[model samples]
Target: MAAKPQLPPTTVFLLKTRSSPTDAYEDLFKAPNDAGSRYAPIFVPVLEHRFVDDGLAQIDSLLTRRQITNGRLQSSTGGKYGGMIFTSQRAVEAFKKVVDGRHASTRENATSSWPSLQDVPIYSVGPATTRALRAIKLEPPLQVSGEHTGNGEDLAHYIQEDYAGWKRPPPTATDGTASTDAERPGPKTDAQAAPLLPLLFVVGEQRRDIIPRVLMGDASESGPPHIGVDEIVVYGTGVMPSFAEDFERKLNETLGSAVRWVVVFSPTGCDSMLKALGLLDPETGRAKDLANRPRTDFIATIGPTTRAYLNDTFGFNPDVCADEPSPEGVMRGINHFMAAWTASQ
Candidate 1:
């Protein structure tokens, strides 16, 4: 009997789903059921915790006044049988509008908190994420991973492995006491031995807003920021093909040949495209079959709506596939991309 092939480690790919206000709410509510019990869906409620009591009452009044419907209320349980689950690509788009609107409002009140990149290694998810990181004066150590693998968990795993075999700098002796680097030990081989820079991976469209806030938070303190990226890359947006292309060209010029990278744009139905191109193995649900694919890369979306569209159409899970701006899972997917890029290099 032939030996069984080993499965590849997980890599995170951040995805953006474009949707309208109504549709986004519906999706958020229904995501729990749609994704089954394995994944938990979370959303920043529009109403503040303090206002929850009155807010719900007002919402009910609006519903009774014909001001809202099962579709208009953005309610997951508004219709019979809890209304139809929003599975259509178009319906998912309705939700993006709400999320984007909220993001814009929050950005106005946000600030950057990252430290200077003089000694930090950066990881990025897409071009926009890189831009945000650059605004804080940090240089990216590597290129963004272009292919969308689906979420941040995969990205984190990839980074851990890609830089796994790297050798750490020799420990400096101090005052009779020995101190060792806490990040990782020495590299496994000469080929794998390389200096480890600060790693940063940008995972979502909101990275533009999130990066600055993170940088600002980092800079406010005396010591280096607890959370920082050596590089940043974006995964999802929905502007236009021309815009994406132009952005890619500009980024290439900025980074020059110092790093390896690629940009993914308008990746709507990209899984199908990859399958069609033979870049992915449909049978195994993996991209290993796509040997001809680019290695290190950055992806950008023309607009928020486009990202939402791809998410809905592809049924991509934002929790696992896309990075949320919150500290918890924000850069998770981008980290996976960095791992893949490092391995390819």
Candidate 2:
């Protein structure tokens, strides 16, 4: 019998916080934010969640104890804390600049149109993030409740439903001529000539309503010609949680396995989406202007907590490259991830 191949040792990288390196490292396996310290390190743990649950549980317990004392608890007496913070001073400075610039631009736009922040629909992932957005006076459109950590999937669903009312002209014939009733090709009897399928952007859990009708391939004499879902784009925001396991089962029932998962890391919101469309700098990360950035089809933020979850759960590395300091550098990192992900697919 052939021996089983041994897997390589997984290396976990830690991104420590400037103010609280110790707390950050200690809570490396669970959600980084659970550490109760702003200075907690951002970690990319390379281990499956099942194998590292104990470590994460220990960290969560430590965090709970520390929260009572404001992170002053000791590791020996029921508290386990120790780790490193991975970040560059330059990156931190650049991120601040980006945030400030974005805020200024948003303020300007809001001032010209609506004076109240409540009028705008801000999209956010968690409570902390919603609070942050609210602090900036941006109203969040959607908020996920419970342990069901929200990711890009929710955003995609929102966008699809929001834009469902929009209608566009159908594609012209191959001859580049509009067809009159008599000149039009006979009703499409061949399956290949079926109506164009709706393009589905499946960021996480596949939403049935959002998938294009053509992809479903449901043919019925009693109902309207079913439009099937055509393409699916998968945005990797966090390790796909429990819902991901049954995704294939659900997908098989509708679109089958012909679909592909296009993974893109859109951390900076619409700016990242525009870059993917090849409209913005693929390398420099410079935008022609804020106006040109693609409106976020959906925004999925992998905060410290989500990042830790992904690292601990899938052995996936969050810090795939050196910490990027500039906006352009971040875009480049995103592009690199997209390319690698596409190749793997």
Candidate 3:
């Protein structure tokens, strides 16, 4: 009888717990593709986050004072902040707590404490964050946007453009009547700048400053005017104490496969992930030689941020960096790597 070819190794995703039917990665690789490459996706929770009470209190104060709003009308009634920005699901969860806390008595009321803030623009980084924000019950519903941007830099630019127009007064028609100019808001003049409010960013203690830097950084001579951003640290993140052990247990169970992959999501779990893979040298506190390491082991990152972290911190370059931070993007990255590896072999 002819010898049969062995199957591709299992792949593990280092991420937090996600519910089924919604976890994109799980849904994507749930079955084998036409080429017959299948992945048994093992998700290991690497980080735990705790809400900061001080931050939540601040958000509550802003909400109660009616400070976070669309600065359409100037005066004491004008909201302190033009709108809100949410990038992480944890931050959204914290915001949800504050929103719900104030309206605990009126849980049945959909418009409960958020009536004054209904018109405020709530910018979300991606679909996950958007879903999280949408899940929160609020009156008039959350005016969420920027979900399609998929990352901070793009979303920041979107915010810069969208918010500028959002805060601008409707353009008056050349005629006496309000014209189609309402459909296309123009930039606010220098005279109108005084009433503009900065964006309120809800963030974690450990977060990328890309949004703030991109939005509020000094504008180039030809660039759009700088947009203001005010960030509140609403949560702190740390590696779970049991992460290393859990990763080791899961990895050992899958070692039977000749080829395996580890998809890292954040820098937070890089150390534990390397240790679990037996790639970290305890004495030297560095990764071992790739040549000496198992050829079957491969590493992938979800985005450039994590990829850059691995490269800078460990002198390690990932085999794949997903073009987009989506399940389809990850699949494309892995498949491309596999094709290149097979070709090289």
Candidate 4:
């Protein structure tokens, strides 16, 4: 009888479709030589991105020169501009459209008579978001966390320490610990040059409560956030209806019970998976109630926000999380996960 070829070492479930690298694993597992033993784990995407376009029109309204009057910074409501929070690259791209307006096709349109927000400290969350801010020509001292992956609570600490201008700020560490209450950030009045204006959070409709919880504190009401955020919905997350239909058929046809590794790149993707898998309630959309997920599955998340979601929502600790929220970081995390997994097996 003829000899049969052995299959690859493992199979992985990649919980991304749109932004996930096409050749991620191919590079990781491509055979060095034609005769060398080949080991490449198969990757199947479990989620897809559907960009919402509702709040896009609102950006044009916020970026008007009228928003900036008397050579002084003002809010969309004509109040003092506290500052802006750039948590995602999507928010950065959306803000650019607002400032760039219809003149985006023209290079001269990049610079408008409206004063630059260079004076206001821009607090960015992700490294990609930081790069996006720079791409829009916003200059530094753009305050960012030293670590690439972090939760909104981490962002809150950075704000309290760096933006709030405390006397002795906490160390820029990624361990997810807070400083003593006695060392809490001092308050900044609205009149000072470095005043702490009411922050205008340029966020999506499905945004998490972590930022509001940390910045604005607890609120007694709904509809309007209790936190100090002058919130604006620059975008919303729509769904790719095809992902559910395709994910199941493909998963069954290819992966079956062999599923070992799963990766979550965003909280939205995580929620979508939970809901789709019947582990979450679609009606309530709350994380308090939970259901059992696959015990054999180990999830690797891309950022701390997603990691926090996994912990807070279902009390499930991720197997591994990316140190850098990039394609390379994803590969590194996967390799580390496989190494440990192999050792255990």
RMSD of every prediction = 24.0, 26.1, 4.5, 10.8
Instruction: State in Å the error of residue 15, model 3.
Output: 3.2
Query: Which one wins by lDDT: 3 or 4?
Result: 3
lDDT of 3 by residue, 20-76 (tens): 337767877777665457887888888898999999999988988888866533433
> In terms of lDDT, which candidate is strongest?
3
Question: By summed lDDT, which 10 consecutive residues of candidate 2 come out lowest?
Answer: 67-76
Determine which window of 10 residues in candidate 3 has minimal summed lDDT. 170-179
C-alpha displacement of 345 in model 3, angstroms?
A: 4.5
Clashing pairs in 4: 82-197, 216-227, 216-228
Q: TM-score each candidate.
A: 0.22, 0.21, 0.84, 0.58
Local error of candidate 4 at residue 222 (angstroms): 30
Rank by TM-score, descending? 3, 4, 1, 2
What is the C-alpha lDDT profile of model 4 across 300-330, one tens digit per residue? 7887778898788766567788886665576
Candidate 2, residue 212: Cα displacement in angstroms equals 13
Per-residue lDDT over 135-232 for candidate 2, one digit per residue giving the tens place of the 0 to 100 score: 33323321222111143344334433332222322333345443233235767422223243232221222223423332244656663444323222
Q: Report how far off residue 252 is in candidate 4 (Å).
A: 5.7
| Of 1 and 4, the candidate ranking higher by lDDT | 4
